[model samples]
Target: MSRIAVVTLVLHFYMAITVSTFANQTGRPNVLVIMVDDLGYGDLASFGAKDMRTPHIDRLMSEGMRFNEFYANCCVCSPTRAALLSGRYPEMVGIPGVVRTQPESNYGYLTPDSVMLPELFQKAGYHTTLIGKWHLGLAKPNRPNQRGFDEFLGFLGDMMDDYWTHLRLGNNYMRRNEEVIDPEGHATDLFTQWSIQSLEKREADGKPFFQYLAYNAPHFPIQPPEDWHERVKAREKNADPARVKNIAFVEHLDDGIGQVLSALDKLGLSENTIVVFTSDNGGKMKYGASNGALRSDKTHVYEGGIKVPTCVRWPGKIRAGQETSFTALTMDILPTLGDLCGVPLETEIEGRSFKPVLLEGKQAAFTEPVFHMWLQNGTKEAMREGDWKLVRDNPGDPFELYNLKNDPFEKVDLANEQPERLERMVRVLMVHMEKAQKIPWKRPEAQANVNH
Candidate 1:
């Protein structure tokens, strides 16, 4: 056991006393969700990362369960993050693409009607805070504090141009709640430090807390601290220099994760805190990000675009050191958390909780067809039913089919050979689109404007 873990065990008695002093739920688990941007499915040691070392994340995997076939709802950032919080398809919540500062370049907006995960946690007696990236909205109506979180200390808009500058398109998006902050540090370190500070505060307050610690690292402008890049270059001598920067960027993020996890232990919350780690989507191909032989890259509807590394850890309460082939989606996180923490599911949600799969190793019972759609490059959309996938990459083009079980890399096109399967999945896509048409994916002014 780690020294922090040892200290946590010794501090359990004090934590119990702390809990007794507050109006806390009897056994509700505190939640810590760590999400990184543009991290690929194979970017961590626990998820087949070859060039990078992610020991802190690997420890979480070894101490809990690593998901084999987990997926992000969208191939981009804002859509997937919105889906994870809303327990619905990204489009259903009015976020079908990346939310940008420039309305002309932006593709999505968070619907005002959506009831978010943080709100549910707050109502369930947990103090809620968002510690990092908040790409959902830039305006007041959709800001983090307005969206449901009690404490919002993070970036307000999309990707940061310079991690240290915390600017996107030369506009500052970093904030401490409603007040803008000009923090001096890398994006990953600042988010991690804010998380530690939040943990320290919540631990002292004796209330169960829900932390959505999102990091904007390894996204674009692959900027690693000079020393971290040098460390990677020295260790992986044969690796490409550009790729070494990506490796070092992710390694530094992993180091932040290590400190965050250590803080949980030192705060005496590790044993009961449920940790969920994942990424918004796959890495950008133009960057030195490796998708582990998966096809295409971020912004495309390939396995490489939507599939991502995901894991869960809750000491003693969860099965450790195992892997599951559950077809989990980012959307399922909200409902799964609702189930796991015994919070009431009052809102209508498209997500089906896989809580049983976590506790009992039960196979995921979600039978609905999964959709991954992106409208930025073209009218790109894909639907999955079991192992079969149908993708329509562009308008005026016929849909293509592939049996993922037989062709995981999407090397073979079965559109002609499996006409029946193609037709069936096409129908599935149409049905989802029909429902999507009812929900506006952009602001009313922008909703009428389609990219293509």
Candidate 2:
């Protein structure tokens, strides 16, 4: 070879190695957590929903590992979200129920000391953004930005009275990083667009981002765009009106998700991004939602209320087209993400990482019994220790026990049949409640003015 050609070949090899080294040093996978509000266990086509069409979500499931027994921290919105972000049980973070606009109706308050998932992402050198719902608080000291998100663009209340209006109890809760702005279009579309924008900006900036896209769709006021509703109605002419609306609503939300996924693919970020899709809780049956074979629905401590459809996708990392029955809770997500991103938890948290289950098909069982609570209206709680479950649907209701391995649907109560087991579980639950009492679910001022 000529001397000039040999020198050029050596230069090209050197540049290639330099570029590879740069990518290796800085290419931490972007984390995108798409959490839908009140999505049912059987809502997606892949999750045994024969009547619904969720192509985008189904495609995601096909390309990822589906979690058969994943659960939210609570049946209600705020508590589950609190657990998800704080990496602790909802009550431990001072959020035992929904956070509402009215102080009288609000059942929980987010403590300032709680360490959020985004805060950890920030410390790990990633740009964090939240686009969609932020139900943890409606005011300062608890807002998304205040809690550690670098950017926040979404609703700040529990649920929107109307999807387009983006209002809750006639008050506008929509915001753009703490600024109240009246954005035109449906909540789902707006959130999707904002999420795409964030992805595009992240691509340009070349910084790994942690984007929590929480959508308040198919929650209540079951409204789908007229055209989408018409499409579903035309397709399912025999379906009930309520059911048609919900199916349409969810399908539209799925399309929005598809758009975000497409943006990731288009920007060449899909291969280096970890996408987690899940819901805050089970669907509300009254609103025409399905939880498959699970018993009861939202607001109750049954399989249907807390069991959510969850999946995670990471190309070349987590194997695709996989399914696992390894039970996990929403709080576990923070530690899982920290594990994936090489970020260490700065403080102690109750969440246990399921990184092993994701990467390998290992059983990442919980050492502690899993607990679920919802304090609104009346306290309802459930505890899962291994295959056995203990449930109390209301304050005065008798505790019901079921061996989930034998009765996945909670069809037969074994509380009386297994007295010793029931007593042992009840004792454990009471101890948990005793410790949680010190957390103070209500705000200090609210507690002080009890007479008022």
Candidate 1 — worst ten consecutive residues by lDDT sum?
A: 19-28
Strongest candidate by TM-score: 2
Model 1, residue 25: C-alpha shift (Å): 8.7
1-452, model 1: which lDDT tens digit per residue?
99999999879978877865442346688999999999977788767777779999899888988888899999899999999889999889988788888877788877878999998988999899999999998887889898889999999988888988888888888888999889899889999999999999999987888999999988989999999988888999998777889999999999999999999999888988999999899998678897888998898888999999888998776799879888889999999999989888778988888888889877745777889887674558999988888987666588988889889999899999988878878887988888876777676666566644
Give the lDDT of residue 115 in candidate 2: 87
Give the Å shift of residue 450 in candidate 1: 11
lDDT of 2 by residue, 359-402 (tens): 99796578799889888767899999999999998898899999
* True-structure RMSD for candidate 1: 4.6
Global lDDT of model 1: 0.87
Off by over 4 Å in 1: 1-25, 444-452
